[model samples]
Target: MDYFIQQLINGITLGGVYALIALGYTMVYGVIQLINFAHGEFFAAGGYMGVILLNWFIGRGYMSTHPMICIGASVVLTMGYCAFLAMGVEKIAYKPLRSASRLAVLLSALGMSIFLQNAMMLTQGVFDKPYPIELAEGSLTVGGITVSYLQVIIVVFTVVLLVGLNLLVFKTRIGMAMRATAQDKVMSSLVAISSNRIISLTFAVGAGLAAAAGIMVGFYYGSVRYDMGFVPGIKAFAAAVLGGIGNITGAMLGGLIIGMVEVFGAGYISGQYKDVFAFIILIAVLYFKPTGIMGENVDDTRV
Candidate 1:
């Protein structure tokens, strides 16, 4: 039972990160029907940004005096940087291809992914960049099971982010415009909604979420790497597909499920095939129900 509880905690923590990254994929897909394969790079960039900012703070001696402030600054700056970067990517790489074929857009996204990966490698090098400070220290133990403070922070932040996203999507005027654009671009244009702006906003928001996830992962794992986005990106894509490609709630559900599956599979079965669990579930879902668990209208999503 204790073992189960421990694995469960670990799974939840991992899921929180997955859910954040998955949100980026799902949101971009939801808004413009583009996969934005480069989204993972945004995650990597965010991690690097966080570490850079945090390290600067540490060097200036601000971290020891004001750790919380330093952390907050890093999160804000990293998210902002990544959000703007994603917006620029959309404008430069994706905007011109809007009228092009889906295949062309897909290829462009892939190309951009490679470009960003190489850019990060050239700039940050191929080595792992260690975080300068630990935001959460120690752990809480209960019933012979232990949970780290970092895990608690990650889960809580994820829940808060999910709630905030729900409000943004369902309650805001911008969100309504986004939904309209997603449902029917022509009709949305006729209704005086600027689809281009909405689409850009969607990318920015998704990138912000991905950035947050990247920073959390850096703190959790103690280091960030230029190529760190690849695996989690793929897993998050799988999670998005499992939940429903364009569905926000579905993305969250899928992320949690994938996290649990991977963690439990590793704990009870074998760590060697941990990634295989998510892939198997993805394949199974695609074979059985391609539309996903809570998915509706495979093309258009309420996100």
Candidate 2:
């Protein structure tokens, strides 16, 4: 039972990270109907930025005197950096192809992904960048089960972000604008909602969330690599599809399910096949429910 609980906690932490990344996929798809393949590059970029910022803080002697504040600042700065990066990518790579064929836009996204990935490799080097181990050193143990402080922080932060997103989408005027634009870009533009701005905002918001995840993942794993985003990005994409792309709630649920499956599969079976288990579940969901769990009501739930 303790083992199960331990694994469950791990699963939730992993799932939350996936869900954060998945939101980028679903949100971009919801608004523009285009899958931003470069979304994962934003995640990778965030990880690198976090390390760089934290190291800078350490060099300036801020980390020793104010560890929590330094970390908080790093997260905020990294997120903002990625958000701007996403907006820039949208303007440069996707904007011109807005009216082009879907294939053209998709190809552009793929090319951008490759370009960004290579750019990171060239700028940050191909080696793994290690996060400061001191940032997440402690763990709490109870009843023979151990839970890391980093896990708790990840889960709490995920919940806070999720709830904040819900309020943004359901309560605020901006959210209403988002929903309206998602429903009908032309109609929303007729109302002076500025579809282009909303689209850019969507990209910024999604990239910001993915950036946060990247920072958290770096803290959790103690290091990051330029190519680290590829596998997790694929898994998060799978999670988005399983949960019904464009449905926020479905994405969260799908991420949790995927996370749980991967953790349990690794714990009980072979660790080497964990990725296989995650994909198998994704394939099964695709076969049985192509529209996804919440995708049946896409018009109502999108954005």
Candidate 3:
């Protein structure tokens, strides 16, 4: 039982990271009906940015006196940086192809992904960048089960972000406009909602969330590489598809399920086949329910 609980906590922590990344996929797809293949690059950028900022703080001798504040500042800056980067990518790569064929837009997304990944490789180098400091270093043990502070922080932060996102989407005027635009772009434009602006905002929001995930991942794993985003990006996309691509709630559920499956499969079976297990579950889900676990038509409930 204790072993089961340990794996469960690990699964939730991993799931939270995937969920954050998956939200980017679902939100961008919900608003623009285009899968941004370059979305994962934003996650990579965030990880690099967080490491850069934290190292700078350490160099300035701030980390020793104010570690939490330094981390908070780095998180905010990295999220903002990625948000703007995503908006820029949208305007440069996607906006021009809006009226073009879907194939053209998809090709553009692929091109952007390749370009961004290579850019990171060139600028950041192919070497793995290690995190400067550990955020939380302690652990608690109860009933023979051990839980780390980092895991608790990750889970709590994820819940807070999820709740905040839900409130923003369901309770705010901006969210209403977003939903309106998603449901009917032409109709929403008729009401002066500015579909273009909403689409850009969607990209920014999604990238910001992915950026947060990147920071968490760096902390969890102790280091990050320029190519780190590719695999996790694929898994998060799978999670989004598993939950229902355009549905926010579905994405969250799908992330957790994928995370849990991977953890348990690795724990009980071969650790080398963990990635395979995640995709197996994805394929099984899609085979049974083509729409996904929460599959629904693109409507007001989406996004």
Candidate 4:
């Protein structure tokens, strides 16, 4: 039916965003076995960066006249900025706590999350900032279902990012170093690989992906907020867990699945419980099989 098709497209768009955010979670966990709870703030920060930069450009009377150039610039700058920001966060908050107990690191992550959230509030103010420029408002009707240009762009970009990430992780030397470190930090160091640098790179890459997602989401929704990352961040985390927390491909699969479920559940069921569906699926998956769809056994994944 047309309605189902519509929801499917919507689901895929939402899933793309979630998968982007989820990659940050999975990547950090894969390398360090520490969940960067503050990763969501990186998403929020990206949105903020995009809007602020666009606002500056619009003030100069240029963004609207050159949408593509403005957008491309914003994305690149935001990703770069957030990448460095994430590295700084790792150096300040996580690096010091690396050898601490798991509980200590977890608490540290939580504290950092709260700190970042409030810091955004204090710096950007507790108000929603609208994206200054709007692009690609056209829509196409296919099979009695209409899809917006923005949706198409988001999906395409998501695919490109995922493919690029796959090539990076599976085909490149840095990726091999990443895997080696993940497999055994001690052994990898013995072989001359720098575990510390690899870990920092992992954070930077993950934050960059999340930043891209944040910019897209801000443009799609027409607004950004200081606390906007909270809910979607939680959903993305659920996606990561659902697909197998430490697996890159699993994060993508889990994100799409979560997105579809959330959209379809809201469309066919009740919107009030839409968020609940993702968590329930996560709980069910964990209960049935402790290791995710593509995850290795617990013993094999020791940190």
Each candidate structure's count of clashing pairs: 0, 0, 0, 0
Q: Which stretches of candidate 1 lie over 4 Å from their true place?
A: 299-303
Task: Evaluate all candidate structures by whole-model CA lDDT and list the values in order.
Answer: 0.91, 0.90, 0.91, 0.91
Worst 10 contiguous positions by lDDT, candidate 4: 294-303
Candidate 2 vs. true structure, TM-score = 0.96
lDDT tens digits, residues 197-242, model 4? 9999999999999999999999899999999988889899989888
Candidate 3 local distance difference test against the native = 0.91
Please give the lDDT score at residue 128 for candidate 3. 98
Lowest summed lDDT across 10 adjacent residues in model 2 is found at 294-303
Candidate 1's displacement at residue 292, Å, is: 0.5
Error of 1 at 109 (Å): 0.6
Candidate 1: count the clashes.
0
90-182 per-residue lDDT for model 2 (tens digits)? 998899998999889989988999999999999999999999745676899998899988798899999999898889988999999999998
* Superposition TM-score, candidate 4 onto the true structure: 0.97
Q: Positional deviation of 27 in candidate 2, in angstroms? A: 0.9
> What C-alpha lDDT, on a 0 to 100 scale, does residue 229 get in candidate 4?
86
